[model samples]
Target: MSPLLTVEELLALRSSGSPRLLDVRWKLGGPPGPDEFRAGHIPGAVYVDLDAQLASPGSSEAGRHPLPTAAAFQQSARSWGLNSSDTVVVYDDNGLLAAARLWWLLRWAGFDGEVRLLDGGLQAWKEAGQPLATGDEPAPAEGDVTLGEGKLPTVEVDEVPEFVENGGLLLDARPAGRFSGEVASIDPRPGHIPGAVSAPATGNLGDNGRFAAPDVLRRKFGDLGVSDDRAVGVYCGSGVTAAHDLLALAVAGFDADRVPLYPGSYSQWASRPDTPVATGPTEPPLIDAAEARRRVAEGAVLLDTRSPGGREKTGPIEGAIIVDRDNLDAEFDFGSAERHAEVASLQTPIVVICGSVNGSGPVAQNLIGRGFVNVAHVEGGAPAWHELDR
Candidate 1:
């Protein structure tokens, strides 16, 4: 059976009153999910607090949102009026990013009955012209559902290296910016696990905000090298959004038992100084200014990644090709019609430089992520280059 249910299917199921609805409306930094649930939520749906009920107290060792203990989760499930044989549907406003957590948690806890995500989530319900309830629903009767543990596979922090070493695909389900180390708000560091692929959970959804058809998702994962022959694992900022990828993999025809979650994810990984973290698409080699100059002299493309004004202040290198630091993806889109001719080929020997090593390192890595092979960055960018001349 599918892991997702359409709004129409949910509505029909409601008539039977056998499926329990869970509204897991949450945002990273929120105005509070309960507040939103109080404003309006699906009729007969109970609000599930992602932080309070779904997770245990977190620390640097665990993630920002570690999984709740099975006993604790059972208590929470009982409070939600979950019966032993009840079908469950979970939804949230932001494309199942939050809701999939509940769906995954239930399955992981060995839920014998079916558990599914409401495709497109609350937005789809509203779009279908469904009526919503305001304020709060009455407290539900305590349920007698018995929960178990280890129904789903998981990867411990120590196992990550071996998993990747054994050719298992570890997918980082965070946004591309976070995966690239361009923007990191919560984690101890930016970037991703050394060998993890940047498979943002958002990509599972189409323009309509619903998950793409199974065949489409299959093609997407196939392109990412997700074959039946290899094991696949997923992780996110904490572990919540990672489930979104797990669900997508299931929908894409991958065996649910084969895909595992790295519950500690980036938050825990980054916290450990001993573990290696990769920034950008690849951690490009850093070349000295003299080496950069020599490479440039040997017909290598010198990609000056600085703002127009920053370049003006530094005095541009004679042969450097200026690229806007903020728009590297667009500037280096080799497949696009407007692709930069100098670095169009994946084999192009490109040397990147910015104001300093801090600036140029990520740019070189970004380029590598964009499929460039022979790429490096100036160790200290313009300042180091100027020192070479002096």
Candidate 2:
């Protein structure tokens, strides 16, 4: 069965019977998913916390986002009114990237019923002129279902090295810069698992933020040496995006039975001193004020990640283009499409200017995820530049 359903198809299904809907909207940094859910969501869509329901409490040993126990997940599933044969549809605002995590989790927890992603996600519904509801949704009756672990294969931290050594492929679903040790944002350490290949999860997305066509995905994976015959494993900063990659793998026709997830991912690997790390590519040195000016003079783009108004208040760093950080991954006018085209077409060096290394790090990495090869971020952000100016 197809793992995706269009908004139109979902509306048709609603006429016959409403499938269980799960709103899995979440962001990495802030603005809790519940707050976003309270603002507005599809009617009857129950909100699920990615950090709470989808993952266990944080542990250095298990990584930042550990998999929830089967019994605990079953309890949460029952709370959402799931049944053994219920058809479930999951979605999020940030494309289907976050939603796919829930979809994969259900299947991994031994769900027998059908699970599908709302192709293009909630934005698709809104784009189709659908109405939205605001406020906390009432809880449905408890569900009669059971869940167990090991239904979907997962590699333990201890087993990962052996799995990779046994000729299995381990794919890293993080941006190339992070994978290459050029930048480290969220995680404590830089670099990737020793033998993993860099395959950014965003690479699986199309211009419209939906998964690329199956043939395109197949070709993309083929280019990376992924095949049905080889045992494949996937990981990301945490396990979240890796699940999206796992879904993409299944979409590309790799047998779900064969592809397993490294749920601990880099968070666990980097924390453990015993595990080895491999850095890739030589990154351009972070530019200071003088170097930044020199680069700008040499045709580089000083990419300001502050809001246009914020940039105005902070004062520009001589020559900088205002491309707000929040809108870097957004859609339409605020999206990276035009910005990416502008950068790629120019083929110039881009130095991201933010509040600090942490602030600019993610923005630069996101650009790298979008295929921008030459990128860097201001070392200490605007404050340091201001200090230099004074």
Task: Give the per-residue lDDT of model 1 (tens digit) for 56-116.
Answer: 9889989888999999999999999999999888999998999988888888899898888
- The residue pairs that clash in candidate 2, if any, are none
| TM-score of predicted structure 2 | 0.74
lDDT, residue 372, model 2: 53
Query: How would you encode candidate 2's per-residue C-alpha lDDT over 1-390 as one tens digit per residue?
Result: 668889998999888997999999998886788999999999999998889898999888889999999999999999999999898999999867688788888888999999989988888889999999999989999999898877888998999989989998888887677888877657777988887877777777776777777876785576567887989999999899998888888888878666899999999889997988887642333657666665667666778777666667777766667775776654213344464444533124577888777778777766655555446677878877788767
Cα deviation of 215, candidate 1, in Å? 1.1
Q: Name the top lDDT candidate.
A: 1
Worst 10 residues of 2 by lDDT: 339-348
